[model samples]
Target: MGNLIFLSGQAAIDQIGGVVGPGDIDAQIDQAMANIERALNAVGSGVDRIFKITVYLTDMNNFESVIKMRERYFDKPWPADTTVGVSALALPELMVELDVIATRP
Candidate 1:
């Protein structure tokens, strides 16, 4: 509430609700981050305004890739983060998801 914006987890689904990158963790992460940016923009915030993030992945082995991708999305003093590996997600083809907490710009 107030200046805080808590967003629900965003996955790699396209505008038509179809998964964007089946069997591709890197593409899935990019799509998920795009979704996060779109949602934040819609609510008067941007990725720079984000202060925390929670990432979910189907495989923990992809953690390093996620870290590398994060560099493209966030700046220094990167948001506090937590990443978790799960057996599955809502869509079997979905490989990544991101939820964030941000402040209005």
Candidate 2:
């Protein structure tokens, strides 16, 4: 069986070692993508190796902008994904959070 990896998304305005707060959705999404990329790299994988992803959004109304940001992270044959609008997150300021699953040889 292949190795499995779980990654957490990164955010820019996110506190370096603290909680996230209400922030720009676009910036939050970008940070989350960066976080995911870093996690993948640590395990010798890249975004292209991802097989699945789940996005947690505090506000579903901004889904369009979130999807647009997501497009920059993956290419053709994009990995399967699920987007969920939740009542709240670990941090109130976090408009979006991404989790990823990847396979490695």
Tens digits of lDDT, candidate 2, 35-89:
7777788778888888888888888998996679658878868888899889987
Expressed as tens digits, the lDDT of each residue in 1-105 for candidate 1 is 799999877999988988898998888888888888898899889989999899988899999988897798889899999999999999888888888999996
Model 2 Cα displacement at 99 (Å)?
1.1
TM-score of each: 0.95, 0.83
User: Candidate 1: TM-score?
Assistant: 0.95
The runs of at least 3 residues in candidate 2 whose Cα sits more than 4 Å from the true structure, single-residue gaps closed, are 8-15, 18-21
lDDT of each: 0.88, 0.75
With candidate 1 superimposed using the best TM-score fit, by how many Å does residue 51's alpha carbon deviate from the native?
A: 0.7
CA displacement after TM-score superposition, residue 28 of candidate 2 (Å): 0.3
Error of 2 at 8 (Å): 4.9
Worst 10 residues of 1 by lDDT: 6-15
lDDT of model 1 at position 72: 89
Question: For all the candidates, what are their Cα RMSDs to the real structure?
Answer: 0.9, 2.5
Give the C-alpha lDDT of model 2. Answer: 0.75
